[model samples]
Target chain A: MSDQTENEESPLAGEAYTLTSEPKLIDGRRVLGVVPGKPSTGESKDLIDEDAVMVWPHLLVRHAVAALAVMLLVLLLALLFDAPLREIANPNLTPNPEKAPWYFAALQELLAHFHPLVAGILVPTGILFGLAALPYLDRNAYLKPRHRKVAITAFTAFLGIWIILTLVGFAFRGPNWGWVWPWNEWYGEL
Target chain B: MKVMDRVRHSMMGRSFFRAPDRVTTRDVAAGHWANFFLHIYPVKMRRKEISFRYSWYLGAISTVLFGSLVASGVYLMFFYVPSPANAYGDIINLETQVAFGQYIRNVHRWSAHLMVLAVSFHMARVFYRGAYKSPREFNWVIGVVLLLLTLLLSFTGYLLPWDQLAYWAVTVGTGMATYVPFIGDRVSEILLGGPAVGASTLIRFYVLHVALLPAVLVVVLAVHLWRWRKDSMLDMERSEP
Candidate 1:
């Protein structure tokens, strides 16, 4: 099929640049090399296969480096920061301003301003559906950042909002979940 | 002299991992095929696929972080009990008395956080690269599910320590489930096993955290990897000759 397409695309295939009789293996798959020059009578082939590296050493070495770096970082973190374990649970006594885990802090923040149904259920579900439907919605084959202007802009905005909300929840919320300035004494309630 | 060198190489290789002194075509093919782990990978990859500048290796790092979390979690579990009566005390005993227990807990906590970040960033990386298009779409969806699983795993485990922090944090977190309109109360009740976060909640969270969620994640991850290998890296598709 490819040979037919190549031949059809090239009007002067036999006259301009003849096909090489020799077939070669590329990335373990057999491929026909096209000799793009003056037509040759003899069977001399020029390999036009894309250059690639064996996964064994090339990709494996990088994977090894990544593994080592992650291990070292985790070790350093474990040594430096002990996991937080607060006072034992007491049903009668609640922390002045209870908070969710940091990752959910953004959603908590959203709940502070918007209705829980909208903030917690609707928005998150929308985001997930949006993510899942992205490939189908945007069928453009190009990957360059400039070509995907709208996607890049919208995603960046979403990330910015997420970070801002998380920051507000993490550091700004205080007693009764009121918005407190970071430098204020009420922040100590956290 | 060369024969003596070959003998020395064989002797040294026998002491360690056995391998030929020089790599050949057979060695390259066998390197992937003969090894259980390496067999997941294709023998040869496009130069662009291995380029760090493109991927920054976020997905691989996320997998490593997840592995670390599981290892550290299991180690910590040896010193932990899920019951509300002993959960906090067990954590304290583990930290102060058990050797490397604090380290294990810390690694598990930090790695969990890192895995969340890594997985989220990996999704972003795939999105920006437009790797989710065409044949790769389902794998992208699988990745999204994995991301959700990572978050749920982290959230469920958040209640394991049974500290005031864990109890109340979970209270606030699960309270969000009550906003689902009609089924909201039922969802919250089901999660807590009642109207509140109590012993039932802790045990439920513990079971889901350690056994159920991790098992699901592993099964889904296998699918993710199978698709990744079968489809090859997206760079192969994007790169021009």
Candidate 2:
């Protein structure tokens, strides 16, 4: 969510009650926070109030660092290799039976038989359009697996099909663009 | 009532098994430091709701795969020359000659396919969650543009091989482009460089696959991310602290 949403959601909460969320020393000396929700001994810093929020900075930092590390490694590699660029493209040799990179070969294979609008343009567009509209679709507030069975199952089925089709496409379809209709080929990728 | 029972006894009933240690009342409480940002929405009405389901992870995971593509793609670039004569040979050499060349190509190829799936799945997850409610409408549009960019990247990269597959695939793909009215032919001409996918086409795709498209994508992605941050993260239960 964005900051705008935050303001909209918290119009009254911030003003509902005044808590010494942040305590400061008075008389320019030191002000001990009289936290209404604190451990009686004050030795343990555990918070006890529903009004208090606890955040794990380390967790967010971990995510941020992981993202940064991966991206940096990619950038460095990119600087080193410069990706392969082929020679002059030949149009006369049309039907060059242009297969997509091995990765996209399946879709290219699908496009090989299906129309571009359907395989290349239409279906993919629909999927994206569908994604952007998700917030309005599944609004159930349950985070547990039991509450999200449909979501989990649907995602798994989708990935399963894609990966399975890809492996199957790679296996049955030889380098020459051949294909097979067997489930065994869905076992793995090269 | 105990918080555990409160959670376990909700309309959907709490999921006791999902990170039980971390699901303390504080995790869902209002106003906390560090993670105050997550509480962008009111919590009382949240009712144990998830943000966009675990499906939301698809987007983050897709971003990871995209990162992998950019890496391996760059590595493949080192030995690849944009000339038609050398393109195929270079690919062969990368496979048979260069160190880790085969691995790089394999990873690049696989991740490219993976990204396509991830992007599509990510979109699907978003749609399923209806996270596009009220104020978040425009980001959805931005997402659509990003999807187009992803496909365009995939399409343009298809011709970089200069093999039978590259030549024929691009030929068929661009042939469709030529059908557009008005400046269709011109557009195809611009795409192929000199009427067809030749040396010019190779260079065109080279420029596009590497420089042009990435540049555009980066800008758009930055905006998309900025919007996400500005729009508040899609958190479940508006959990803060």
Candidate 3:
């Protein structure tokens, strides 16, 4: 009781408020009495509204599940498929199609259409720089899709074109980088 | 649960954990803070951020794939010698003679391919979520660098099998470097370590794949996660308004 009264009378008493009858320490600050109504500032309210949850069981458990799921996927894939291994590399004998890895398929497709400068050098450099500069270039404060139409549209368009190009290069192209029906003759290598 | 709690409360456990029993939120937070592994994560995050839809956990998926790659890559390394003479034979011998070599190689191959997909998907997801805004902008740049590194690592590893696919693919791939304006030839030569892909190129790619690039990625990834932790609690929506 004496400690409670002392806390209430102390210079820091106005900041120290209790939710219980007994005086207690929270974060090393003594609690006196509960202040009625809302916090003085909106900042505190916003923080409360954030609904912050502990990362331990909450986020960690989710991450663990995600990790396990991917591991299982890799394990299953390893079981089902054998990684491709062709004959020994010979400089003189290039494969008819001579494909880059699938991830670079888009660039290879572009190289088929455009000059080496445009497809090979400039386009890749532009894409990387553009991606890196995205946050700064599109300084729009709004987060919702409706609020940021132009950025979303532009990005989606690029992504679509890139995906299409990748598909063309990876599966739809045959010898001499010519178009082929993948269903008829599969040239894709993984 | 009881046995676990008892262990947690024991002197050795207490010393290891550097926190009391997890009876309260404070205790949990304390334990998290004390943990070296958990240091990468924030103590708290908004409820929405933890939901699967918010992130699709693509970043976590990419990381796990990378881990799988690292494990399988190390195993492959034990059997591989980075030379045209030994490289192709080693892969064949590994697939036939070595225990689980084919499976581990498959794991590495699939994980590499999946990692490329996951990282790219993560970028798209981040863009859609507008997660690169303001305070998170630099992390986005770091992510781009990571994406480039991932591609490079994959491309380098592609050549290790010394198969016809690898040889021609790299020939075509490095051939593109010759389009880089005035310095084109120089860049191509530096990358190939010769007029064409040969012994030097294999050794060069091997070192970069195993040592240099992975080291850079790990360091950059550490910074990326650290920044993520620091910015995790920021209310970007409110801050903008």
Candidate 4:
């Protein structure tokens, strides 16, 4: 039959103007039917082949190797060295430096510097809370790392500064309340 | 077969999912360095790639540190008791005997320090990236709670060693907690388990360090992670630096 004749005699000629034609995936519970004209190409490939993707091997490689590497080293070291456990609870005697585990020494240092609420309770608490709350706060539609350069740069700089200051505290300063600088210390007692 | 050759490919839906079947950082990491090193489990961020930078690695570093702590912590647990009465002595024993315990202790100690720093850096990364906007607001809140829990975990862990540093630090810490108006004294007592860092306080801190806080942080961290999956990673493709 001619195309025009078929069109004229179509099942419902009254609905001819409203009729349209296209194909889409059969996203039924049982099967996802394919849409017509969307020839196989580009990034749409992963959706077409479910069987191959189900065994997502890359994810396993990323998580498995890095995690396992660290664990093994620590375990071997634990086996090799005995961790220091302090003496039985004595309510009395105090160690000389009275130093905190190195990390808290900064807070110990800060607690030394400011009120406990600010250093111990508030600031650290606020920062941590602020950190966890971050994803909820900034909802802009910038996905690629490069697109959000401001955020990236800021984060990078902050991290750099933080690390520098932390190391400075651990390395240059003593357990004393004194805040020392190179020239300042040379001129002072030491 | 290459992912591009498949039939259902779409060009516009890049934001929907992390174009599965594409070459990931893990694939490259494996291809590049797979030949060497220990067993490295590359736990790919299940969400979209937030950024392609070194800073992104900070969160991963924290995970590594936590893993270090858990492993060493378990070993230390073998000989250490949590009682305020026996806590200090156990520390001494681990230091003196049990074979190479000192290194384990140092790693645990240093990693705790590193975890705080790493988490802080990871937070800063999220913030400047504007990754905290809109859909991610709840996750940000979760991150904040996790942050507090991390600090609390660190604080509680401090007293377990029971050395002078532990004694005085907690002394000062709990002492400071009492500054709150009505609850100052009450809170201090609660934290101290009586009035000062004594038997009750030691046991309290031990339970907190070994049990309570970790559970909370892990749960929160899980949520924090799951939300990332939901909102997708906040990789802003516009900014540079």
Task: Residues B140-165, candidate 3: write the lDDT tens digits.
Answer: 99999999999999999999999999
Q: Clash number for every model? A: 0, 47, 1, 73
**What is candidate 4's lDDT per residue for A1-190, written digit by digit as tens?**
1321222233233433232422111211111232224334642545321121211254445445655655565556546644444444455765433444444445555666687767667765555555554454444467566676765675567556556655444444543645556445421110
Cα-based TM-score, every candidate: 0.82, 0.57, 0.89, 0.61
For TM-score, candidate 2 versus 4, the one ahead is: 4
Query: Model 2, range B1-241, lDDT digits (tens) per residue?
Result: 4676567556555343332223334433422322334433233322112222434456665677777878878898999999877888889888789998876876676566557767777666665554544456677777778877888898788777776656766776676566555676888888888876689888888999999998898788777766765654355334422
C-alpha lDDT of residue A116 in model 1 = 86
Best by DockQ: 3
Predicted candidate 3 versus true structure: per-residue lDDT over A100-184, tens digit per residue: 9999999999998899999999999999999999999999988989999999999999999999999999999999998899989
Better of 1 and 2 by DockQ: 1
lDDT of 4 at B158: 79
Cα error, candidate 4, residue A178 (Å): 1.2
Which candidate has the highest TM-score of all?
A: 3
- For model 1, the stretches where C-alpha displacement exceeds 4 angstroms are A1-50, A183-190, B1-23, B233-241
Recovered share of real interface contacts in candidate 2: 0.17
Candidate 2 wrong stretches, greater than 4 Å: A1-190, B1-56, B233-241
TM-score of 2: 0.57
Worst 10 residues of 4 chain B by lDDT: B34-43
Ranking by TM-score: 3, 1, 4, 2
Scored by lDDT, the top model is 3
Better of 1 and 4 by TM-score: 1
Identify the runs in model 4 with alpha carbons over 4 angstroms from their true place.
A1-55, A72-102, A105-122, A125-176, A181-190, B1-61, B64-68, B95-107, B233-241
Model 1, residue pairs in steric clash: none
